[model samples]
Target: MGVRGLTTFVKNPSYTHDGSTTLLRPHQLSNTPVVIDGKGLLQWLYFENDVDCKHGGDYREYETICTEFIEALHQRGVKPFILFDGASNPDDSKVDTLLGRCRERIQDSAKIIDGDPESPKLRPPFTTAVFLKVLESKEVGYVFCDFEADSEIVALANIMGCPVIGNDSDFFVFDLTGGYIPLSSLRWKEARQLSIPCEKYSLDHFCQAYSMRREMVPLLAILLGNDYVSRETFDDLYHRVIKRSGNIPNGPNVRIPRTIRFLQSRQNFADGAKRLLKDEARRQGKEECIEKSLQAYHIAPESRYQAYLQQDPSMVDIPDCPLPAAYVDLYRRGAFPADYINLKFRNNRKKLLPNLVEDYIRPSCHLISQRIREAIYGILLHGLHDRAVQETGREGQDIKVFIVTGMPSLPEFGSLPNLERMIDLEEERRKVLVMEVLEVDHGRVQAIRDDLKLPVATTIYWRSKLDLPVTESGHHLMRVILLGIAICYSREDLNMDDVKGNLKEAPRVMNRTAVQAFAEWQSCMYYTMHLNTLVNRPYPTPDATKLYHGTLLHRIYATTRLQRDVNPDWVETDVLRGSPAALALFRHLDGVAQNQ
Candidate 1:
């Protein structure tokens, strides 16, 4: 029988009554022997130091969950097996100690075996050492696996065959498709059910169904948007455009007044010190001594410092202010100050504060909006439409889809009726009959019955606000197109040659230039805003020139123009490209293109 459990039981051979009067034979006969293998099931669980455990609860909770799960399996006639990392918890060493106690408690009733006999069970070895000595002396069937070191020990059950059991999804992610079976939640029900289909899903089928490129999930995440670059870039670009346009209206003149006051205060301090020194010189009976004393400190024989002090001594001793050491250190370390850091730390914090706020915080707030757009694109590409075709092996002429956005009364729905009417008009006039928008609404969508009035089979609602820039909209649309292509290719099992052939004859909706331009614009804007915040603020940097060469600005301009052509009334493009901002953006683009 295939059993999934915490441990394998070795039947005591001494209890057998087969006329072989041997003690081992009797014990083996009395119990149906099974050996639990730890090695085979190591991939099912992840062992990390307690510090890395982000989920709620401690090692005690983990032990409780495991124990309960194992007990439930035992009640269902399925054997339970337990595996543990030899390493103790980082925070508390007692995790391993407590687990050893649990193992001893269960071992008296069930089959008990030591994985590593030599390894000390406690910090100061005691009971486990005594137990190991007893088991070894008797020559019992208990096998001690060679797990002396701190590495993960894999115990392979010696029984002919056994089903591996676990509820961890990481097993599927890792593509462990051997004799594995899920101990599903349904197993805990009052009426135990044994004949469940616990077959491992084929990795190839999972990848194909999801339209995932081989081992490219991390890459896709980076491209779509990640915490590191995309967010930072968008923030940078937004601040740059805002700063260059001088749209911020609230603050005092950060540059002129502060500089003047700061300089004048230093000048007053220098003058006061000079006057006091002159008084000291006069008191010491040397009328010309103050000049000679100041002269001694001058670097040059013909000192500009002396000359400056003679003319305006108050302003002369003001220090030559270099950039802050902390800022320089941060720059060398390749970390830009976050918005809060810029606002709080460094000298001249006020001057650069607005840029940081606009760049970092504003862009971060929009990440969810961007993700929502990407999710919409994902749904259109990989959701039920592709699955229906793949499973049925039939590509229907018209696929009905329902997109539920959960927005009850968005203003954008007002335009949907007109869009649907236009699609109907175009289908009749062109006779192509390729695509259609069947229905438009701003409320919860219900399935269409045979007698329903709705003409379109697929229903998609717009729940979120649609305030995204035209460039972003175009980028999203391109992703949708790519997803559509991927889905078609995935379903048809088309080879590279077949895909190329289809591409050649595929209806050209958007040109390469237009698509490229939109992508470039989005990237540029993101970077430009990011750089402006880094430079204008008290952020650290080694080489500001190397940082802001304008590749991003160039891309933004090119992409924005393309986006403008596609949708003329987008105010963001106009706002972003206003006089000074436009000149700065164009200058950067020109520099990059020339270098290219």
Candidate 2:
């Protein structure tokens, strides 16, 4: 149940001399005196396997332990009430095999029976039929309980007025009370005599203290200790350490300071001490004193203290700075204190205090308005810009813009009054035409065309589909692009070459493999030149044919395949055929007369 490869316990037996009869007892049985000796008493036993063990091969160790425990119980005149949630295999017959093995160890006079009758449906390799057969033929009583399901089994036990035993704290989660004891804990020398007072502790009391429905026990552990961290932050730090240590074997351990020290000394006292100092400083408010104490302890460097002061000058007046450079240095050196390390790295007090308050006070309305503005901008750049550039053959600043305001009933257009005011300021600095599309007069879209005053023959009310009221000003820009203009497209329509050239200027965006692949794929699809020709022509010579045929196309194809694999939904087979503009240019070139 704990970490694998750690120390575990095995069961054994005991014998005692009574005045009238020789007495036998299981190692964990209570020392209470009984008038009868050699009388068969039913005993329930459970085994906790190492989680790290693989199936089949790992059962040997568990079998050995079970055998020892069962033999010890037999010598003490105790009958076995064997309950196993057989291994997670599909076969239901294995339970019988396990029962048969147990029968071999005990005296023929002593009976054995299965404790769990609801086990079959859960898909354990054993079924209830075999268990029932064994119990009836052997004349042993069975306690049928469904520990995995609802709390009714606990009630069933109370109704029967019999004792129950299992190790998990989860037993309380099922509203179980009275007659329940943890067998494993009872066997421990430290735990033999300490009995929980069930009368004072009701099922509700246990539920309130440790309920499975609430946060998990592990999460509760971190929160109680004030050291919880988020999973994302820990993963990020793990990768950073892995990168710093290179790709060498044991690199993760080598990069992590505490892990390295633990491996070296077979203990982690140095790291534990540093965390203690930090926790102490946080509580005491004496930053300078903590720094000096850490220095005296020889756990960190002096430069760290100076660095902390330099980073935040205002902290000089504050009693303590939790993030003192010395403490960070100690953390870097693998000497972090246990308490600080125990703190959850991502959601700890230090990380959540600043963000939590702001989030609690933030208004949802403001967030919605910002999101709408961003969506509009994306539609303009990605949906409309590309088609306009490709169809008109007009480059750069020749693109026209218009805005209209005056729609009243439409939901999206209703916001035009506010949107128009914002656009008014933007239009003053840019070459844009603005107009109002009235509802009653000439069609709102036609009015926009009149306002544009350009010789445009078409008129499109993009706001119509948007389900927004078509205010004259609100309709102008989108109307002109979608209807007035013969060709309309968004920034997504732009050639891949143009996008690639833009991205090359931003190195940070292309640092990751996914981003780099996107940029390259865009260049291949939109760039106006044949990439293969560009590379092959440069090295033209006797081996040019070999390079062009073998090296160049192969690499490009591989990259194309990788792009398709990475973004399966977006970059399909047809999209990778190369730049449409460049292909058209070649077609035009091929039509010219050769003799001329």
Clashes of each: 45, 47
Please name the candidate that would achieve the greatest lDDT relative to the true structure: 1
Q: What is candidate 2's lDDT per residue for 166-266, written digit by digit as tens?
A: 54333322333343444543342232232221111133432232222221222211111211121222233235432343233452223222222222232
Q: Assess each prediction's global lDDT (C-alpha) against the native.
A: 0.26, 0.24
- Compare the candidates by TM-score and give the number of the best one: 2
- lDDT at 577, model 1: 27
TM-score of every model? 0.17, 0.19
**Backbone clash tally (model 1):** 45
Q: Model 2, which residues run further than 4 Å from truth? A: 1-52, 58-61, 70-140, 143-152, 174-177, 188-596
Worst 10 residues of 2 by lDDT: 351-360
